[model samples]
Target: MHVFLPDGKQLDLPEHATALDAARAIGPRLAQDALAATANGVLTDLVTPLPEGAEISLITKKNPGQAQSVFRHSLAHTMSQAVGEYYGRKGFPKEAVKRGVGPSIENGFYQDFDLPEPLREEDLPDIEAIMREIIGRNLDITRADVGKAAALEQFSYDPYKVELISELPEGEPITFYTQGEYVDLCRGPHFPSTGKLPTAFKLTSTSGAYWRGNEKNPILQRIYGVAFASQKELDEYLERLEEAKKRDHRKLGREMELFTIDPLVGKGLPLWLPNGTVLREELTRFLREQQFQRGYQGVITPNIGNLELYKVSGHYQNYSDSNFSPITVDDEQYMLKPMNCPHHVRIYAAKPRSYRDLPVRLAEFGTVYRYEQSGELNGLTRVRGFTQDDAHIFCRPDQLKTEFLNVLDLTVLVLKTFGMNDVRFRVGTRDEGGDKYVGSDENWTAAEAQIIEAVSEVGLPYSIEPGDAAFYGPKLDFVVRDVIGREWQLGTIQVDYNLPERFDISYTGEDGQEHRPVMIHRAPFGSLERFVGILIEHYGGDFPLWLAPRQIAIIPIADRHNPYAEELRAELHAAGLRAEVDDSSNRMNAKVRQAELSKIPVMLIVGDKEQEERAVSVRERTPEGHKERKGVGFDDLKAELLERYQTRA
Candidate 1:
């Protein structure tokens, strides 16, 4: 058979040839340096048989993207060997530690094990030492393919591996890798030898994970590690990870009294306290005004809908796995709403429309529910229930770009208003030859092209992502980087042509005939709960004055001045500011410290010196700590503070 190199050079070899053979045929120097090879854009082990007419590129350490994964996977095997040795030194047999699967993930690799005893944080160092020793031994990594009977016998001591082997279909290749005294069942694509691996790895932590992510499966301990090309890169990532720990929203949420997830209330449902509610209200009002300016009318929707509604919208058919099981009521099935688009569609179809109503905009802060796995639930980012700032625009085909651009403009404004300036979009189109999506190819292609043209005209960078689109049509998703250099997928705009057809909704055209209106589903804040959680971490709990739940904390030095503080509070409240007076028995300094801890944006302290002139001393929180402005007149201060917050400064 003949194979091709990257530059289209052909090489003839015998039947059942491997990449290693092709490398040697090309040159002895290339063969010696090759760790692995990329066959038709997929990285593969050199020992794997290369197909006829395959385009291949031998990979060395120079290939950053492909080589890192190769060595990282090799490290997983080496780490497993060290784990067994560690257990051996502890006087435990190899069977005491049952191994599951391990794979190279982003920035790291991990292996799951069913251990006789749980591993502790202090034991990680010992594991690392054994791994380094194994790598230093310069053991060769070799592979072999075996028949099912032999493979089953080889791993029969381990039920996990046996179960895996039994599940493989007939005629599938079973391969195993060996280095020194350790051997394990795994598919190929590893480094040439253990010594060739980089030492830039750390076993970060360990947690319990189900064998295959099913709650019903046996729980295995999953050890996580981070790997990089160099120690410098690993060090930088570790530092960022430490910073991220400080900015964790769950920790800050409790400290700042933002929200809580009570087990009794449910796993993913968050109960917002007063301060947190204020945050949501402020964000809602900000976007509400923006929508009002763009002629969007707000509407309400039910939390649950008839099962038939989702069937017509294709949500049930295409996304039933993520949706909760239907509720049977009087022989009628209803489901917790998985999306707000179907409800918005009914609203548009409820009334008659003409060419003047070509673009009917319906918006809602609609709460929707999904059946998220318990293991998949995070603070607010991944939840079972959340509210969406959803809006659906039904416009004429000719007005598609204009209306999309209008929504895009509003989305940009919304993100910018909260200091999300660094942003990019992704055009998620349907996967070709896939049964998961709805709509015809012609319509799918048109929607995808319209999205591309729209984002391109706006001159924002975007990348095409196949299989990331909505089940109904193509979409454009926005990803913004936060202060700590973490990128988040916040908002999305989808151009859907399938839902309207399935629902049979239309508008009268200028030609005096009923015409289908192209529907654009948009959510500027994809999930309000998630958006707030990101904001909490982005600002590190130091919210801007306008967005701060408690904008001001008023303190009086003496009880005699409590009445004055109350007066100041009422006055600020009337001016639409969230203000509270610290009338607790705690001393004035303690009260001021408490305000700082609560992360209030402003503090006003009144006493005999200031009360004599009906004034207050102000302390404002800034990026560089709090600044004090003494003896400011009440009228002047009130006016200045209100203007600054009103302007969202």
Candidate 2:
């Protein structure tokens, strides 16, 4: 059989020869450095037999993207071996510790073990030390395929492994990897030897996870660790983790009094505090104005709708798992609307239109409900109920590209407004030969083509993702990277022919005959709740002046200057600035500190001398540095703030 390399070199090898054999054939150094390989673009273990006439690339520590996974997964196995050794030293029988599945994840790897006793956080250091010792032993790792009967017999004492083997399909190969005294059931392409594995790894923590992720199954101690090819990369990642902890939205939300969730109000439902509401309202107002200028007419819809509406939209069939049960009332059924598209569809269907009205753009700040499981719920990112900045545009086929481009413009404007400049696009199209999507193949092709063309015309950096499309249509998602280099899917614009046809909505075209209109579904802010959560974390809860809930804090030097502070606050409010006076009986410095803790954008200090001068001491919070401009006229200060607020500076 012949295998190819990226340089177009071909090598002939015997049948059943693996990537390791090919690497050895290429050169001794190549074989020694090879950690894994890819056969025809699919990552493969070095021990796995390469397909005939396949293209293979030998992965080494230098290949960060692919090498990281192989290294991390191999580390997981080593960690398991270390755990068993640790337990053995503690006087437990080798067979007493049952091992479950372990796999490599983003930035790290983890393994699950059903231990005789629960593992504590303190055990991680010892486990990590054992892993280092195992690596130092230079153990030769090898993979082998075994018969199911023999594999099950070998793991008879471990029910977790037995259950896994039992669930394998008939005739599937059962594979295992061995390193010295530790043997694990895994299909792996490990390094040539343990000595080749990088030493830049640390066992971070341990947590409880159910066997196979099923609640009814036995709980196992899952140990997590992060690894990298170089210590520098690992250190950088660890630093990012520390910064992420400090910027965690949930913690910042409590300190900033942005939002809250209570068990009594139901899980995953966030109650927006006054400060949080101000943020929400400001964002809404900004987008509302943008939409109004873009020819979007706002509409209001009910929280719940007739059950049949979703069925017609095909959401009920596709998203039933994420939807709450129907509410039956007097022989009729209703449900909390999980999407606003269906409601907007009804709105379009309510009236007939001619070619002049081909493009009917309807926008709404629609709140939706989905049945998210308790475990999946986070602060606000994963919630049962949230509001979408949704809109649907029904236009003629010829206008599809133009409408999509317009939606893309709005999405870009919205993202840039929040200073999210590092953006990428993903054009999600249906998978070929898949039954999951709706609409005719011709319609799907046309809709997908329009999206691709629009994205190309806009010259946006994008990649096409198969099987990431909505069930009803293809979409373009705007993925924004925040300040800390975390990516968030913030906005989406989908081109749909399914919903309009499913609802049988039509408009008169130039031919004077009724024709099905193409629908475009767009949500610049995907969801207000999730967007705000990302924003809070992105800015580290210190929002920009335009988005700050309390734009200015007026601190009085003493109680005697209360009237002057109030007068300044009124003037600031009159100029459309959000300002408040610190009326509490506290020292001026304390008041300033409290205001700073609240993350107010600007602080105005009032004193007897300032009142006599009819000027306020302005302390403006700039990203570069905080500055104090003394003896500034109140009117001048108000003008500058109003200018910043208007320009969104």
Q: Which residue pairs come into collision in candidate 1?
A: none
State, as a TM-score between 0 and 1, how close model 1 is to the true structure: 0.94
The per-prediction tally of clashing pairs is 0, 1
Q: Cα RMSDs of all predictions? A: 2.4, 1.7
lDDT of 1 by residue, 235-265 (tens): 9989989988988999988898889999999
Q: TM-score for model 2?
A: 0.97
The numbered model that scores best in TM-score is 2
Q: What is the lDDT of candidate 2?
A: 0.90
